[model samples]
Target: MTAGGDVGGHPVGPDVAEAAVPRPGPVRRFLLRRPGLVDAAVVTVFTGWALLLGLGADSMYWLHEVLGGPRVLLMQVTSAVLTLAGAVALVWRRRRPVLVAAVMTVLGVLSLALTGATNGFELGVALALYVVATTAPPRTLLAAAGASVLALLVGARVLPLARTVGAKSLGVDPDDADAFAAVTGSGPFGFATSPAWFAMAAPVVVLALLAVGLGTLVHARRQRVAALAEAARARAEEHAQRTRLAQASERAQIAREMHDVVAHSISVMVALGGGASAAFDWAPDRARAALDELVDTGRAALGDMRRILGVLHDDDGDGPAGDAPLEPQPGSLDLPRLVGRARTAGLAVRTSGLAVTGLDALDPALQLAVYRIVQESLTNTLRHAPVATDVEVDVRRRADAVEVVVTDRGGTAPATAGPGSRRGLVGMTERAAAFGGTVEAGPYGQGWRVRALLPWNEGDA
Candidate 1:
């Protein structure tokens, strides 16, 4: 009955403390933390893929026919240069999207004008369109998409004309005009002369739209992911702010408890020390009693301070000693020891209802509140009522609440509204209010009285 035990005798659990440190998710644990490496790896893999396709196309018979003799060598050299340059531009697309898109666009157009073939440059342009859509502003993304679509349209129209002209310039007859048309379903002016060639432009148009649409969809997905990430970051910061505020509040409460315990104990020891010194000159036996009271009061105060310190130290989940358990907090059952200390301090304190029932049914916090209220009341009586002949301590349990009333006969000392006095009253009021309780302290009849009504919800046990 001297201290509050854990209701369930349970040690501290991990549900709250362990959740503070989270395990990283799969993507986050893998490549997401290394964005630069991921980007470089993506660019390298895509560019190498395009280069392989371009080199395979170079070995085809059609390229030899369209670009024959010295012109054949010229086109191969031009293709190599454009492929390498376009690859470099694509690699830097995320950093400078607009510039990369522009470079890819020009390379696509030059390849159409000279080689008249689909190659690595065209693939680079498509990849750059994707980069633009994801990284650039909305207007810039739309413009880049439009430019890519335009290049596709122009390539379809100009490739046929370029092929005929390139063949004549290379002094090679283009695979016989009728035979080439049959194979490719196009002529020198295929868009104008051939219905099938004009129909083929439809798929090219669809392809362009599909590329732009795919890029836009990817961009939307990226935007959503970024928004979610930002929200998570904001919530984490808010939670951290709240935790800091709670820690500060807990520290302040601990300080007040320490102050009440230490201040009251010190006052009693000092009073007893003075009494012992004065009595020693007249009566040795009286002096010996006061000295013994002084020693006992000092030791009690030291024990209380140590308990308060344990509460403070254990806040960080580290106990006072690895092998030793912390002391239990004082409760309503501890009021006798508290009153005994006051009597030893030389206060004429009398008690009623020492065996109050249903005390164990109250919550530990409420029990502590009741104990502190009585302790602080007795401490104040000892400090301000030295001449008072009688002080009464009462504990009563009603149907819905537990009531504590402390009354002391009037003292010759004048009542002062000093900081320490006001602080003690405030602490008592706060403790009661925590459990939907109320406290009233004022002069009653011929002495000071403190009455506290603390709610007792037995079901809370």
Candidate 2:
């Protein structure tokens, strides 16, 4: 199927949905979202605190009665309105944290001024402080913290404490001061009578500030580390994808060269051998010798081709024989056989400069490279040189490299060019390059010559 088209013969639709469905109202939709649920829970906790402190506390009884009277019912109504507004501020705490924090801070200061101290009101202040520290940037948070500290100090000085000490001095029963002291420590209006009230309150405020700063630093550090790890993983995956693409391209090039080298040469050898066998009675010894050489040459080519095919197939699975040793190819040791094969193919083959005596032994890969170069050159001569041409095969070992030359003398006219004439030269060059070697091939002195120089101890394949 074509890309972006369905298998059922239809074009693919847009990736994103086109139609918009009508959603419920803001409150209903918010209740459905996850953050909305958390906001609802926070508001509920604040409401419970307001109820317990504003209505249920005995200390608030006189205040409630005075406010709840019909003559001044607006005071109680105002208190209820302020309490609800503080709780509602939490709904937008995460989405608009700075705005919510400012609203909560203003409401908290007003509530303390009007009622002295309420139950759930301190929670709003604490939540505002947390939002300022965690959600805002460092500079903004620091500014907010400084403003909050100033507000707290102003509240401590301006808001009057309930008359607990006067009740004790007058014969009226006094309420315990521990609960009030817990929430509002020894400042100007605390239960304590010490002269260093500001000193004691200073440490508590500093501790709260330090706690918020540390929490913000830890959270920011974790987020940065997570971002770095995600970027590293993406880069690693991209590198792996590029590596696979390169390997696939290399495999395709190898397959094309193998098809040209193995298929063309072997097909010609098979046809020549068959013709020679059929004409054996007409020409006895020459035909028989040609047939024998053809058989040997075809077998050698088949073996080399099989080894190459095995390597290709092995890439898809474990391998044939599950790790059996690969069958080795012909090297300089089989040069005579290669020459005989050329002779059988109707070419006069000669050799010179093949001495390897008293020289350091060559690596197996280099030996195979020299052999393939000679083999391809002879195959090209048989396929391209004129009939009755004499071919020369030469090999010499240098200090660090082995030089090979294949030269042919044209007899009458040049032989007809076959398919992939240039490709054979490319394959020969690729083989030499695989072992850090170089090849030169062109027509010279009435015929063509191919030469290759391969490193004796180069480590590449």
Candidate 3:
């Protein structure tokens, strides 16, 4: 299976756990990638050693003397066959560990029965048990162990050497059944002929079962912990992604507000310049003054736009910066220039309750917001109420609040549609709300009217 696929169905069993195993360094990693080659090399060396031992003087003598006269050949042949089968089975051990373990266990029993001897076959049985305990599923390994223990018990009963050893050690009179009872307790313990026999064999069997159970539990626990850790890591990554998306949405909203402010201011300059250019021949002096005011208004708008853009361009633009100082932004202090520009554009603009002192008392952001609101209001009047001969502007500062109102005299001219109509009004309302303020703009007596109320402490500018 591919590495990214579900680990459960991986060709290697779950007990071949990635967590229990340490990551191999360069040389060891290279060797592990081709396990077949490594197995082939190991098997070749083991086969050579087994062959050499089978042909050796001491080994041949022991086998011939221990086994019967004519049966010696059969015993040697049986041992050789079991050895060859086990070596071949190791090649596919990981793919079918349970089946290979069962096969090896049966071969062990067969070798013992045929030769009545423990040799290379014994080593194969031990290696098979290790593989079963390490790689097979829990149920399969338990079944294999049960089968192996049964085989071992039966083999011990039938083998002459096993009987002789058991009888001598247990002190049981072979002819007397009552003596067997005296030595071995009844029930499960009765599997052995006597207590002495149980004492010799039970310890080894118990130790093997304990090792297998402990290893399986350890492997399972580690796997569960690793899975939980992976899940937590995925959750953390998802949260970070959501936070970034929220931040991006807030920035887009700010950009739209700035665009509305700049667009409205630029539209006024364009309209005034167009009107002055068209009347230059009929009213040269008045038109020239209007043209000059248009230049100043255009420059002021550009400077305000650049300042707003600078904030938009900054990395920490969304939050306050306490350590770094900020320059003053345009507000009511620039209202006289705004009024003069509108008057030059052929509207009679009158000012009352105007106070330019203490302008620096307000926050820079609030100041800028106030300037944009007033500028947009005057621009709207010049473009939409051109025939209105007189306009009134009022600014009053109370102990707790500041109020502003702009109105134009009744006229017959229809209101003109411009780029900043609906969008500019929406922007002004949003800006006023930002500093706990409110604005009202619509037709009120004869011409359009605009009014804003800002709190002194809360909406200072």
Candidate 4:
């Protein structure tokens, strides 16, 4: 078979895998897909061709006929039958390449012995040798090749043919000559030129070796193609896995952003609206002022949402944005605004070291984490704790870390806001953990306190 055909189960080379190997065309691929059909065709064609060559005049085929002598019908029939058997053996050559090669070589040698020539059937042995070379181990190949070459020399009667041809040309009857069949009155190795039979058989021997070499090349190329295809599949799978991880991480970050922006903005707005409603009847101007604060709070929340959504839109080319320019997230500089919002929401918010010491010098990502932590803490207080609650936000920046502690004194009861999803605390915890930090949230003497400590990264600093 040609190199375009499949060896074992590896499809030789499809177009994509033909980086350096020759790509099999449509006809070859179709034949390769049905190896059984290909084998049957090859066997049939080989049997036909070899049998046709056997139809020549003399029963001796080439040797005696070319030397001008005897013919035998029984010997000719025997050679034909053995040639047919060798052709049929080709059907199983792929399954048992080494065994088939040995069988065909023996049959060819027998044919040469019985008919005085191979009768054009030695090609079967070469075909099997090719298959053997493709699949066998290197040592096995070397052994098989050595055995086949030796068999070829013996079958062609290398010494006998040379001697017989030389004796015939010198007017001696080769059939009556001795084993060496040397020229009349000449020593065994004294022939001046190469004999005719040996000259013809030498090319066939060389062609047999070439068959093995060609098969080796074909096998090597098929292995390379299979390896390339396998590597490509692994790379594609890895890329898909990376894509999945990136998408999951992005979704989680978006969830935290949504909770921080929407939850905090809504909680503060709810507090202002409730205050405005409570004072609407008792104090008209104060209620009007509260309503103004509520409107400002809503607008600011809208702007923050736009910015967040805009970032999403820029990244994925989707989502709503009110043309808010892409800007960095709120960091240490934005904490005062956060505390001011809580105060305006009617919480008695106080501060200690809210100013940045080395916070601005830290990683921006870490700063964002700190900001989210503080924002979530205050949002929980405004929604869960009573209004006019006394809240103390303590921020301390050290050489290696920044700590944020927001604690609120309990009021008479729960605030006007409804129960929360409690996702804010989870967001805070996740944010801190990402930056190698920690958060603690629970009841502190009948009040709620949320503490977060974020470290300064040496690389970021």
- Cα TM-score per model: 0.73, 0.65, 0.57, 0.72
lDDT (C-alpha, whole model) for all candidates: 0.69, 0.62, 0.62, 0.72
Model 4, residue 245: C-alpha shift (Å): 1.2
**lDDT for model 1:** 0.69
Q: Which candidate is the best by lDDT?
A: 4
TM-score of 1: 0.73
lDDT of 3 by residue, 89-194 (tens): 7666667766766776676566546544333433444445555676667787788777766666565555554443344445565456666546543455454545
lDDT of 4 by residue, 16-38 (tens): 23443346899989988999898
Per-residue CA lDDT of model 1 for 1-461, tens digit only, reads 01221113421222322333444579867876787787777567656765565445533346566446677667767767777777677668879877887887787677667666545555566677777776777798788768776775566555764445334333345657764454334545545654333433454456456656787887787777667555556555554555567678788788778878976777677667767888898988988998998888887777777666665554555555332345677887788988887776667888986578767567888878888898888878767776567899999888888899999987766643233448889899988888898999998777889999998765855
Clashes of each: 0, 0, 0, 0
Which pairs, if any, clash in model 3? none
Model 2 regions more than 4 Å off: 1-91, 113-137, 140-211, 231-235, 242-246, 249-253, 256-264, 267-281, 284-302, 312-325, 353-355, 358-361, 386-388, 409-411, 418-423, 457-461
